[model samples]
Target: MLADGLSLAKMNCFSRKLRRTAPELGSSKNELVPSKLPRINGWSWPLHGFQVVGWLVYIYLAIVSFGIYIPLLPPPWNHVVHALMGIIFILHFIAHIAALTIDPAEAGVRAKQSYSSPVPLFDRSKQSHVIQDLHCYLCNIRVGPKVKHCAACNKCVDGFDHHCKWLNTCVGGRNYWCFFVALTSATLGVLLLAIVILFIFIQHYLDPNCLRTAPQYAGIQGNTTWLVFLPLAPVKTSSAGLLIVAFGTLMLSITCLMMFAHLMAFHFYLFYKGISTYDHIKMRRSKESNIEAGKPPDVKTNNKAPKFLQT
Candidate 1:
């Protein structure tokens, strides 16, 4: 009877212990499994703060230049300038949209992993590179020679160029053309706007009448110079307003030109060299690493047309 009672007590204790450990065991099991890929809300502007800022800046500049400055010019010239700037802005907007929405992931990765699936965790300890033998560790799939895993996008991009923070996406094989168009349009637009602003500034001093040619400024009499913020309301021109607008336009033009011009020139150089931005960066890093390791860098010579320009 005592043995039976003791055995019952032991079984009850074991059941209680199993109940207590069950959740822990299950949690440990869960830990062993790979976690799902983070949901990348590409359409969410807030997710890409820089992208939002870029859009806002573009809108502000467009409004100030097209709405305010352009209208200050004479009839035909103002209309012509407005039309040209409008076309460039439209091209830029369309290209920007295309670059942002296109998926640049490797074909195999895109085919194998659905949006809902858990991407396999890459084991860096077991591999030297994210891709070895054309196989991606994280994606657990075969990829093309130019495929590279973008840490920012957390996906293997085919023909990876570079991740553009402005577009909040990777620029790769699919969207490279669109990105180039956007860059070109933006650069051109800013340059034209700067020229017009400079012309307007010179005209403001040399022949203020040319600037006030717009129909809205007809009511204001001589010596009481006025500047229009919005079309309907014209306020007497103040030194403060003139300085603010002039300085603001000048700063925006200079900053944007410096950035966009440099970027455009760099991309042109990359094309001339028959390399993508990723390749250039990787080569630079490799060279640096080799120098650090006290190893002489390999030298090779090739006299061939750039891949981009090849027939």
Candidate 2:
């Protein structure tokens, strides 16, 4: 009936550790108390760097598009607009990285032993709601309700959400809000870039003179603009620059915007239903004992999340 090897304070925090470690139930349970584990490694950092570098290049080009490519354009498509877009992109970009790297507040893994459930005051004859909590063999601890054991991290995370390969970490109770905000900001930043690029293309077709990149071929500027690299018309340096902006900034911006939009919408529904993307994708039955059931501690029946998780 005792929590065995751990102290009172340590027992109090044991449930939290399940929400933080790798989820593998097969890991060695030697450590009695949870320790901070490394999130990024040499093998994973390269892929993470790829994501960082790709976004950096895209953001840089979106910012410079205003100053170099189409300065002669009219209001809304001018330096002011470009500067605004750049600022937005930078702000959201920073938010995304910050959320990605921040620890999702891992739980403390404390080994637990055979324990008897306490009786409630009003129902001394009958026990209050029991969540049917499971034992994490790998962590060598009994897991609490809604705490999902990650086999990959070989640790348990409370309010376990999806594993974001981009961040190279699991998104759970601690970082869900930040993850949502990052997706939102990144989407908007890229969308603004797309809008700006689209406007430039529209202006080019309507009045080529308005486009700085419009070809100056024999007093009759052809259909080539920043959006088009080479039409039936001769190629100019400005037009070539426009081509880069077209495929590079515009396409990438729209693609990123669409992806984040879908992600935000999906997560919004998850928030409304009070579930996580992990639950939706895997749809594991949490009622069983084994990890294959993907059993998370069932908090709704009895236990409640902590103050920080509620936030």
Top lDDT model: 1
lDDT of 2 at 198: 76
Q: Each model's RMSD to truth, in Å?
A: 7.7, 13.8
Return the TM-score for candidate 2, rounded to 2 decimals: 0.57
Q: Candidate 1 lDDT, tens digit per residue, 1-311?
A: 99999999999999998877543432321123344462232463346778888999899888877666887777798889889999999999998888888787877867776766666443333333556567766777788788877766667888889888888878999889999999999999999988888887888778878878766666778734657564666556764576478679878988999999999999999999999987787666666556776877553223322222211
After superposition, candidate 2 runs with Cα above 4 Å error: 1-73, 76-79, 109-135, 140-143, 212-236, 284-311
Model 1 local distance difference test score = 0.73
* Residue pairs in candidate 1 whose N, alpha carbon or C atoms collide under 3 angstroms: none
TM-score for every candidate vs. truth?
0.78, 0.57
CA lDDT of 63 in candidate 1?
80
Candidate 2 CA-lDDT value: 0.54
CA lDDT, every model vs. true structure: 0.73, 0.54
